[model samples]
Target: MLRSCLSKVISPCQSAFIPGHCITDNILIAYEINHSLKLKSCGQERSMSVKLDMSKAFDKEAERCGSISGFRIGSRGPTLSHLFFADDTLLFGKASLQEAQHIRTILDLYKAASGQEVNFDKSAVVFSKNTDPTVRRSITQLLNIMEVPTHDKYLGLPTVVGRSTSEVFSSVKERIWQKIHGWNEQRLSKAGKEIMIKAIVQAIPTYSMSCFKYPDSLLSDIQSMISNFWWGDGAKRKPIHWVSWDRMCLSTNDGGTGFRQLKAFNLALLAKQAWHIATQPSTFLHRVFKAKYFPTKDFFQDESTSRPSFTWRGLCAVRRYLLSGSKWRVGNGLHIKIWKDRWIPRPSIFKIVSPSDALPEDSTVDCLIDKDSGK
Candidate 1:
C-alpha cells in the first residue's frame, strides 16, 4: 500500500517529489521574499546570488506538528512524506553573503516560531563565488550526520559516487536524445507506415527538441495533436516557421517549445541590462554607463549599455534577425499573382517618397491631383 501510494505520488519520469500540496509552502516562501525585499517603482538593480542549505530538517518533528511534508532526501522521488515542517530547503538567488546571512537569520526566527530549529550541523550557507565547493562539502557533511548507509539509496538510486559535473550533464543529454530516437523508431516501425514515415521525415525541423518528464505514450499523443493542428486534412497549409537559436528559448516567450538553451538564455537575460541602462535615467548604473559610453548624450539619447563587450555582436545579430521579415499589407481582397488575377479597389495613384524626403508640402492637394495630369 505504501509503495502504491508513493507510486501515485511520484510519476515514473520525474526525478523528484512535486506534489500539489507544496503550493502553499512555495507561496509562503515567495511572500517571505517579497516582504523582505524593497523595490523602487521602475529602477533596475542587480541581484546577489545566495545558496541555502536545509538537508538536516527533522521529519518526525514535522509530523508531530501536523503538517505533511515530502521531498527527495537526496535525488530520488515519491518524496517520503511526513509533516510540512520536515522538508529541506535549497534556495539560490542573487544576493550577497551578508544579505543571505541576514535572510538566514530571519528564516531561523520564522522556523523557531513554527517550533523547529534548523539542524545547523547538517545545514550550510554559501555565496555564489563558493557555492559549488560549499554544496559538495555540505552534502558530504549532511550524509555523514544522517548516518546514511553506504549501500542504502537515500533519495534516488544509490548515488554513482565520483561522477563529475560534465559527466552528469552529458548523461542527462544522452538520455533525452535516446528517448527522442526511441520515439521516432517506434512510430516508423509500424506496418503501412512508409508514407507516414515520409511525412514525419519532412516535419523533422518542427519536431520539438524540448525535454519533458512525460511518458512515451503521452508524448506520442502530444505529437499527434501537433500534427493534426498543423497539417490536418482540408486545412490551409502554411510554411512552418523556424526560430533562431536565441528566439527558440522558452523563457523569452510563452509559446516556445520548452527547450531552454541554457547559455543562450543566460546571455539574453544578462542583455536585459542594455535595455535597462538605455531607458532608466535615474539609476546610478545608467549614469556610469552614460559617462563611459555616451559622454555627450542625455539618457534618452544614450544607447550605451553595460552588456559584456563580447555579447554586443551577438545581440546585434539577434536584433537584425528579429527585424528581417517581409512586409505585407492588409486589404479587403487578397490576390495571389500566380494563382489568380489582380484584385483592385477604387483606382488611385500613390506617390512613393525617397528615404530623405519629408511629407509633400500640400498633402491634401497632392491627393486631389489626377494620376495622369501634367499639373
Candidate 2:
C-alpha cells in the first residue's frame, strides 16, 4: 500500500524513493565526485568534501538549506552542494571558516528537526592540497570534525587523483593477493580455481576498471599474479605452465577453459559505462561529462586531447570497441553514408563492400530502399 501510494504521490521528477526505481546506490556513487582540484599551492582557493555518517536522512527543510556555495566542475556544469547516501552524506564547499560554519548550521538544524543525531566522530573532512594550512585548521576546528588526509576516499573511491594512477590503484592488486592467499589454503582442484578466478578475482577490480584505465604494466602484473596462481601448487614451488594463459582464456568449445581475459574484460566494462553516457542523456554523469569534455560535440565525436581526467580517458579509450559493436538504426537513414559508416552486419567491415561506383560514395542508406515498400 505504501509503495502504491508513493508511486502516485511522489513527483515523477524524482528518480528515487518510489517503487520500481532504477536509480541504484552504485549509480548514485558514480556521480559522487564534483571533480575540480588541480593541486594548488597554499595561497590558492581550497575546496573540501565532508563525509557525514548519519543515522537517518532528512526532510524538505534540509533540501531548502539553500546555497552554502558548492564548486562547479566546468563553466556550464551545475553547482553541487551536498549528496545524501544510505549511510553517509558528502558536503562540498570551499575551505573557508564561513563555509564550514554554514555546513555546521545545516547539520544542527537537521538534528533539531529530525531528532536523529549525526555521527560526528565517524565523520571526516578532506581538502585540496593547495589549500592553506591555516584555512584547513580553521575549518576543521569550526566543524568539530577530524580532517582526513588528502588521499582520503569518498564512497570507496579516491577523492583526489594525483599524478601516479598506478600507485593509486595498487590496492586492487593487494586485495587480489590477499584473497588468493586465503584460498590457496584450501588446496582446491583446478576446476575450483577456475571458478574462483572467474567469479571473485575478476570482480575485485571491476568497480575501479569502470572509472580508470589501468596501466599496461599494472595489467600485466595482475595477469602475472593470476597466471602464477593458476600454474603454481598450494606450496611455494612453481608448477610448469602446460598451456599459455591466452589459450586457457578460450571457450570450452574452443578447447580451453573459458576465463575472461582481464584487459578485454576491463575495456568491455568501461565501454558499458561509455554506452550509458552516450545513450542516457538524463543521467547526472552524462550531464557532467558532456559539459566538461564534449560541450560542442557528441561523446563519440569528441577527440579532445586536452587535459583529460582518468575517468574521461577510460570512457574515450573504449570508443573503438563500442563503435565496432554498434551500427546505424536506419530510421530514415538521412545521415548514414553507405561506404563510410558501419551499417552492414557482416564481419571485418560493417560498411557495404563490392562496387563503390554502383552507388556514389556520398550516397545515404535511404537511397536503396523502395519508396512504397519501405524495405
The best candidate by lDDT is 2
Stretches of candidate 1 off by over 4 Å are 1-48, 53-101, 115-172, 180-317, 325-353, 357-375
In model 1, the clashing pairs are: 48-94, 48-95, 49-94, 49-95, 67-83, 67-84, 69-83, 76-155, 76-156
Model 1, range 126-150, lDDT digits (tens) per residue?
2223224444345434322221212
Residue pairs with clashing backbones, model 2: 40-130
Task: Tell me the TM-score of each prediction against the true structure.
Answer: 0.27, 0.78
How many residue pairs clash per model? 9, 1
Cα lDDT of candidate 1 equals 0.33
- lDDT by residue (61-87, candidate 2, tens digit) is 433565466656567875666655456
Model 2 spans > 4 angstroms off: 1-34, 39-46, 58-65, 128-134, 148-151, 303-305, 330-375
Q: What is the C-alpha lDDT of each candidate?
A: 0.33, 0.72
RMSD each, Å: 18.8, 4.8
lDDT accuracy of residue 134 in candidate 1: 49
